[model samples]
Every structure is written in C-alpha cells, then in structure tokens.
Target: MDMKKMAGDKAAEYVKDGMVVGLGTGSTAYHMVNAIGERVKNGLKIQAIPTSKATEAQARELGIPLLTIDEVDHVDLDIDGVDEIDPQFNAIKGGGGALYREKVVATLAKEVIWIMDESKLVDHIGAFHLPVEIAQYGSKQAMARMEECGWKPVLRVRDGKTFVTDNGNYIADLHLGAGFDIEDVREKLGTIVGVLEHGLFLNMCKRMIVGTSSEGVRVIENPSK
Candidate 1:
C-alpha cells in the first residue's frame, strides 16, 4: 500500500464509536478522512469537527457526520498532518493555510495523533517555510517584526493575489534558519503583535504514525506519556 495511505489506515484503527474526532487538512489527512468515511458508511458512529472549510466540505461529501467545535466540549482524538516533524516530535504544519484552526482543534483534543509518510520526518525543523497567520490590517508591521527576529518573512500569494486563509487572514511564510530550539522559536514568535497563529506546534502531539515502504508502519508515542 502507499505509505501515506497506510499511515492513515493505521491511524483510523484508533477511531471508535461514540467519540468526537477532529479532522485535519492536507493530502495525508485527506486519506484519513476517506477512511473515516468508509467506517461511517459501515455504521460506525462518530462526530467530526473539521479544522478547515476544505476539510469540512470534503467530509460532508464523503457522508461523514459533522459538528462545529462550539457544540462539543472536547475532542476525543485529533488526527492531522505535519509539514515537518523533528526528532523531538515538535512539528510545523499549515502549508494549506489551516494552522490557526488546526491549532485550536488540536489543543482542545484529549489526544492528538499526527499521520504522515516517512519523508516528513526530520532531524530538526525549519526546512519547509514556517507559516504565520497574521491579521490583514497590520500584516506589513507583523512581517517587519518577524524580519527583526531574524526570519525571512515572505507574503504568500496564490493566483497573483494574497493568499487568504479560511479565517480571512494573510500568511507570512517564514524561512527560519535551521537548528534552533522549537520552544525558543515559538516563544520568540509569540511575542510579536498582529501574529495570530504560527505553524510551530510544540508538546501537543501525543502519538505519531509514520508510514514507511520497507517497515510498513511505525507508531511513536510521546516520551512524556
């Protein structure tokens, strides 16, 4: 089986009936949504809260029952994708511009599981440009502040226009120089104004299922667990 698909299938095994699940967005996460759809069709009962409008529409098309976060106090589990996962299990996500919503959903979940192909694993992060969601009004100020912090902040444009996220914010893709501590980086970025959210996720992933062609699959648990 394709490694990404295999990883999603394996993660789907953790989904059970009568639970609230947080659905993620991305190619890898799309596979998981399909797997959950098949289970729902087979009479499995679950309510899903999608982190992005794209994911919400896709899940509805697949007939997976959906609910908004306002309706649920907590999510039983959250399965999402990551752009880069470091050795410490800290991750950078939001390549799809869903980081703000993804973070909200993830932090609310009792457990968060990241599913990915082995290619996303890294020794240290900052390879893929980090995504930072900033309010449009003062976005220029935010980018300048980010540059002051030693990052190359580039405004993301899609189809010749500013890339607007589902939340209607602009994106600043930060090319952070490699080899920095994830927590330190997050703390530094958190101090900037107009910075609504960033892709750096720290100490939030409870489990990670990595799919490999030769190994089939590997499930790594959080060391603190």
Candidate 2:
C-alpha cells in the first residue's frame, strides 16, 4: 500500500465545511491536496491557502477555492508533511524548499497536522539535514558563520544551479548529525544575519498521522496540545 497516500487521505478527512485550510507542499502533501479536491467536488465548502506556487496551481486546477493569507483571519487547520519527526513531535521540514511559507502558514494556523509514512519517524530529528532559508545577499558570509558553528552548511543546488525557493531565497542544508541540541542550533542559526527561516518546527504540531505497513494508518495526538 502507498503509506503516504494513506496518511494524507486520512488527514484530509479532518477538514470540515466553512473552514480556512492550509494546503502544504511536497509528495505526501500532494495526496492530501488531491483528497481534499475530491471533497471539494462533492460540495465541501472551504477556502484554502497554498504553501507553495506548485500547491496553488494544483489546487486551482482542482477548483479548490484559493485565498491569500491576507484574505483569511486565520487558518483553521494546516496539514503538512515532515522530512523527519521525533517522538516529542518536533520535526524537520523544508525538503520541498517551502519552509518559509510553511512556517508562515503554521504560525497563523489554529491547528496543525503532519502526515507521513512510518519511515519518517525517528528517535531524533538530525538524521535529515535541516534546511535554513537565507537571503541571497551575504549568503556566503552567512554560510561561513554557520560553518564556524560546525553546523556543516551546504548550499542547495538543483539542475546544476543554485536552487531558489519560491520566496526567492536560498536553502542551506545543515548536517548537524544526530543528538544535536535543537535549541542551541536554532538560536545560533537565528543570529546569522542572512538567515530567514529554518526547518525546525517545534511545538507547532497539534497532531500527527502516520501510515504504517502493519497498522495501516495511525493517529498520534500531540500530548502538549
């Protein structure tokens, strides 16, 4: 079975009528958006904010009502995917280069849900390189600063060119190894002048749904929620 599809489709069921939804980016999120689109075709009434241009286009093609962030007072629920997630519900995102916008949407969301396959679960979050979005201006200096802190920053490149995010920023993936101090690294990254946002999503998830081979789809409510 397609675990990503299982998790994503399960999360889409949470969207109720007359709610403002935050549609996320990436492969797993693609399934959620597709499921939500089907509901829309069946008369689900909801306005949606897409986290990336790709998501926006998909939602538009599916006739999902699109609304800018400015048009909505707040997002009722934001369903997204994570690269890696710890037992504590902390996660690493931005593998899709949508971290900046994803964070923005999550910040304004009253509730957040992350859907993922079982493989994404981990004892710690550092296995997946954390992505930090930075401005192009002085990016080299910023990366040098990150190196000085031993975060092992690497500029993201795609198709033989620097990968630019939809927000027109560069992503620096940090190889922080396992068991690194999340707070300390977050603080240090924040001090970098060119840094705009990092992939560390701490305390923002309200629930997590995982698709497992054995159990099928499992839902874990955030204890802190």
Candidate 3:
C-alpha cells in the first residue's frame, strides 16, 4: 500500500463508533478524514469537530456528523498532521493556520494521535520555519522580540497583503537556526506579549502514526506507566 494511504488506514482504526472526534488539518489529515467518512458511511456514528473551515467543508461534503466544542464534554480522539516531529513527540504545526483550533481539540480529547509521513519526522524541529500566530496590533514589537530570541521572523503575506488566518490573525514565520533548543525556544517565545500560539507542540500527543516510504506505518505510543 502507498505509505500515505497506509498511514490514513492505520489512523482510521483508532476512531470508534459513537465517539466525538477531532478532525485534523493538512494533507495527512485530509486522508484521515476520507477514511473516517468511509467508516461513517458504514455506520460509524461518530461526531467530528473540524479544526479549520476547509476541513469543515470537506467533512460536510462527506456527510460526517459535526459538533461544536461546547457540545461535548471531551473528544474521544484527535488525529492531525504535523510539519515536523521530533523523537520526544514535540511537533511544529499550523502551517495552514489551524494550530489554535487543533490545539484546542487535542487538549479537549482524551487521546491525541498525530499522523505524519517519514519526511516530516525530524531529529530536531526548528529548521522548518516555525509559524507563530499573533494579534494584529503590536506585531512589529513581537517580531523584534522574536529576533532577539535568535529567530529571524518574517511576516507572511499573500498576494501583496498579510496572510490572515481563519480566526483573522497573522502568521509570522520564525526561522530558527538548525539544532536550536526546541523546548527553551518554545517557552521563551510563548512568554512574549503578542504571541498567540507557536507551532511547537510539546509533550501534547499521546500517540503517533508515522508513515515511512519503505517501512509502511509504525505506531508509537507514550508509555502507559
């Protein structure tokens, strides 16, 4: 089986009937949503909460049941994609501005299972431009502070204008040098006044389904102890 499809298939097994689940964003998550739709057609009876408007549209087209965050006490599972993931299960996400919702859904779920391809797995996560969503006002101040913290911050603009998130925020691409201290940088950036949320997801995932080009799909779960 193709690795990406295999990863999707593996992720689908974690979704059970009658569960309120978080539907993730990005290509891998797109595949997962399709697999879930198939199961739903077969009477999975799951309630899906999409992390982005794009995802919500897709889910609706597939006839997957939808729910709001306040409608459920907690979600049974959350399966999403990451830009890059380190051995510690720390990840950089939200390249598509779905980070805030994704984080909310993941934290609200009993289990978070991040699915990704082998190319996305990394020994370190900072090399890829880290996405930082922030309030519109005081953005320049935030950018300068990030530079002082050793990140080269660039405002992400689209078609000659600032790229706006689904929630109407801006994304600053923070370019950190290779092998930077992932945990320390995450903490320091998180403290900045204008910072809304950074791409770094630390110790938030309970499990991961990693797809490899040759190895098929492999599952890594946090120790039960």
Candidate 4:
C-alpha cells in the first residue's frame, strides 16, 4: 500500500460512530478525511471539528458532519500530520499554519494520533524550520525576541504575499540548532506576547502511526508510561 494513503487509512480506523472528531489539515489529513467520508456515507455518525478553514471547506464538500468547539465537551480523537517526529514522539507541525486550532483540538481530545510517511521521522526536531504564528501588531518585536533565542526568524511568504493563517495571522519560520532544548524554548515562546502558537508539539500525541515503503505501517505508543 502507498505510504501516505496507508498512514491516513490506518488513522481513520481509530474513528468510531457517534464520536466528536478533530479533523486535521494537509495532504495526509486530506486522505484521512476522504476515508472518513466513505464511512460517513455508510452511516458512521460523528461530528468533526476541522483544524482549518480549508479543511472545513473540504469536509463540507465531502458531507462529513461538522461541529463547533462549544458544541462538544471533548473530542474522542484527533488525527493529524507532523513535519517530523523524534524517538520521544515530540513533533514539529503546522507547516500549513493551523497550529492554533490543531493544538486546541489535540489538547481537548482524549487521544491525539499523528500520521506521517516514513521520510518525516527524524533524529531531532530542528531539521525543518519551525513555523510560529504570531500577532501582526508585535511581530517585529517578536522576531527580535525569537532571534535572541538563537533562531533565525523570517516572515513566511507564499507567491509574493505573506502566508496568512486561517486565523489571519502571520507566520515566522525559525531555524534552530540541533540538540536545542525544545521544552525550554516552548516555555519561552509561550510567555512571548505576540505568539499565538509555535509548531513544536510536545507531550500531546498518545500514539503515532508512521507509514513506510518497505515497512508498511508502524505504530508507536508513548513510552512515558
């Protein structure tokens, strides 16, 4: 089976009837939504909270039922994609700028599962420039602060215009050194006035399903038990 599709399909199996689910963004997540749509068509009843406006639009078109956060106390599961994952299951996410909602859903859900192709697994989380969504008003100040933390911060732009998030905020790409202290940096960024949320997801995922060309599918549960 194709790695991307297999990752998505396997994650879809975690969804059950009458559950409030969190729908994630990106290509791998798009495949998950497609699989869920098939189950929905066959009467797998559930409400979905989409992580982005783009995903909401896609879910609507596919006829997957959607609900607001206010309408649900807790989500049964959230399946998302990560840019990279380490041995400890720490992740770098939000390449699509939906970190705010993704984090909200992941924290609010009972279980969070990340689906990714084998190529995304890394020894450390810094290989991909972490994306941080920030408020437009204090971005300049925030950028300076980020640089003080040893990250080369740059405004993210796509097709000549800034890549605004679904929440209408700007994104900054941060380059950090390998073996950098992620927990320390995450706490530091959390105190920053302008940041909405950074792409570094720590201690959130309960399980990760990684798909590979040769291995097919690999499931990893958190080892901190």
| Per-candidate RMSD, Å | 1.0, 0.6, 1.6, 1.2
TM-score of each: 0.97, 0.99, 0.94, 0.96
lDDT of each: 0.92, 0.96, 0.87, 0.89
The residue pairs found clashing in candidate 2 are none
Q: Which stretches of candidate 4 lie over 4 Å from their true place?
A: none
lDDT of 3 by residue, 56-170 (tens): 9999999999998778889998999998888888788988878888888988988888888888888988778889998889988998898898788999988899998888888
Off by over 4 Å in 3: none
How many backbone clashes are present in model 1?
Answer: 0
Candidate 1 lDDT by residue in tens digits, 90-192: 8999998999999999999999999999999998888899999999998889989988888889999999999999999999998886676677668888898
lDDT of 2 by residue, 93-114 (tens): 9999999999999999999999
**Quick one: RMSD of model 2?**
0.6
The count of residue-pair clashes in candidate 3 stands at: 0
Residue 40 error, candidate 4, Å: 0.4
Pull out the clashing pairs in model 4: none
Ranking by lDDT: 2, 1, 4, 3
Q: Is candidate 3 or candidate 4 better by lDDT?
A: 4
lDDT of 2: 0.96
Predictions ranked by TM-score, top down?
2, 1, 4, 3
